[model samples]
Target: MSNTPLVQMIGIEKHFGGVRAVDHVSLDLYPGEVVGVLGHNGAGKSCLMRILAGAMLPNEGEIRVGGKTVTFADPNDAREAGIETIYQTLALADHLDAPSNLFLGRELKTRFGNLDDARMLEESRKVLARLNPNFKNLSDPVSSLSGGQRQVIAIARAIYFDTRVLIMDEPTAALGPSETAMVSDLIRQLRSEGIGILLVSHDMHDVFDLCDRVVVMNKGRLVGAHGIDEVTKDDVLSLIVKGELPADWSARNLEAAQ
Candidate 1:
């Protein structure tokens, strides 16, 4: 509920041997805002987010949460700082049940210092019900659920843990229209709950529909970031395809209008 940015990356630079994976990329995300990252393959969008989520270390640059600098050596560090990344493959254990998956690494402990099945189940049910009422039983395996249901579980897990920021990668990739709409509504619900989100998606429709701002990246460099009200789908396409703002895409117009 702070008015300050939930997360910010300034002049982030990362390299792999001789290759520069991230080049002077900068971004700021505010609480309850959904910032969409758009780029072609190899544009460094994923690499930059990986660094933010603490899945990978950056060669240079600084990350700040609520205006304080942080050094995250691992994803756990980011999680401890209230950041969550929902990847495409969803780091979920398909063999595990809903409650087990919800409390995977950080299990609720009982009074006797063992796994607290009741606490975990109760918490999981409450969170899931708030997010998705159809989350019938906590004993169901994820592999048996639909793609949207599985994603709902992952999102519910993050929300239950009080994560202030979420970085979702291609969340609607394999979902049907109805499923995508459900996820979209859930995203809005999270925003209303005061959680910031960094959404990475190739789907222009999703980006244009759900995001407040759109960031464009190309060849490991940030081309630009614009408010959704300022640009159209055509403008976003131009940025992604040309690696530069098109002549017709007036950033100044977008900026002033926005």
Candidate 2:
């Protein structure tokens, strides 16, 4: 992993009315690493990630990308900063074909200003070929495609725009074993390409299998963060449920032992 973080959220906090949806929290994602954010419903993990994705603003906090502080008024600003978010919905246009969906809002236009269908199709083919070689339904509407295939489209759209930081929310949820494995393989490929990923997932197996590190949150506060190899599933569960670490586990002891 790189010594310098690819993305950092420092002292992030979010509130909805009188409720503190996200308490002061700080997290970092490094290139070529996957950090899993695990929390129960209403635990504020999604709120924290939304702040980073620019879908929601933090009440107080700062975000740094590539070592420079930045602000995002909306998701477009985040995309401009090389950050892309893949929500659980995948957010593809069901009525459109792969090429059309790939460049939905940001379409390639001819010099004459018409939708450059041919060029868009060609570019979509190239990117899909890289992400999923078996993807051949370029002309069919995405609604007819399988779940795994839909995910490929969403991911291709993100990476095609030079995305460096990806926030994936419940990427494998509702996926069958085979489809889940496919998505996992794609995540590994993205990591190999040096794209930092913030994975928000509820599946313990997925977290253990795909994450380099895991952070737990409860009641809008970050309970603890642990390297995958340094913590057990039970330990993580305790943190999630009680917002407390194991009695023997402390940052000082872990550092000294390391």
Candidate 3:
């Protein structure tokens, strides 16, 4: 594996009318590492990730994957580049079964041009078994599944497509404790598989427990980046609320300031 990051968003900027939603934000994610993005509601973390996911374009910035600069014209371009985003909605068809939902737009077909249901189901089983061993209701409509099960399906779909960079937005927002733990375990599994993850979440517990690093933003500006061992929950909250670097982070920059 090379030292280059799996994905890099440099100097990203997004403006809406008179407001700069994201200003000169830069982030890097590496394989097998989960970097949690934290910010208040309007702090601009979502805007930056959206640009990286190809959901929205930035006014100024460049995205590089595998050390090659590329421009994403749309989400399809991002997916083709091995980037998969699992939004909070999960984006599944309620009436469809697991296999049908997994192969929603990109269905596999047989030589005769018919849908390859057997192959699709087999692949779905393999992926789901790896992600969620308890997910035995593959033939049931997603509407009948629990919140955690649905999340497993969403994640299984992403990994099934050979996803390299996975962006998960508020994955456990609506889950109970057990479901949250289930999703957290799946995230750890994905990280162990050498997938680069950009996790956007407001849950401090999730960030502290799951991420290797935390990147904070405030009012469209990058506040600071801290390794998991470098900051505490209070330190992160201070940064998010007041845009202040942690005391230790400030200490590291004292000589540079002088």
Q: Highest lDDT: give the candidate number.
A: 2
In TM-score terms, candidate 2 sits at: 0.91
- Model 3 bad stretches (over 4 Å): 246-258
How would you encode candidate 2's per-residue C-alpha lDDT over 150-196 as one tens digit per residue? 98888788888988999999987857787688779989999999999
lDDT (10s digit) by residue, model 3, range 1-258: 348899999999999998999999998999999999999988998788778888898999899999999999888889989999888788899999999999987899999999999999999999898877877998999999988889888878887888899999898887788878878987888889999998999999899999999999999999988888778788899989999866676675565457
**Positional deviation of residue 137's Cα in model 1 after best superposition, in angstroms:** 4.9
Q: Using TM-score as the measure, which candidate wins?
A: 1
RMSD of 3: 3.0
Structural similarity to truth (TM-score) of each candidate: 0.92, 0.91, 0.90
Local lDDT at 2 for model 3: 44
lDDT (C-alpha, whole model) for all candidates: 0.88, 0.90, 0.88
The pairs that clash in candidate 2 are none
Quote model 3's TM-score.
0.90
Please give the lDDT score at residue 72 for candidate 1.
94
* lDDT for each residue of candidate 1 in 85-175, tens digit (9 for 90 to 100): 8887777899899899989888999778999988888988898887678778679788898787788788777777868999999988867
Cα lDDT over the full model 2: 0.90
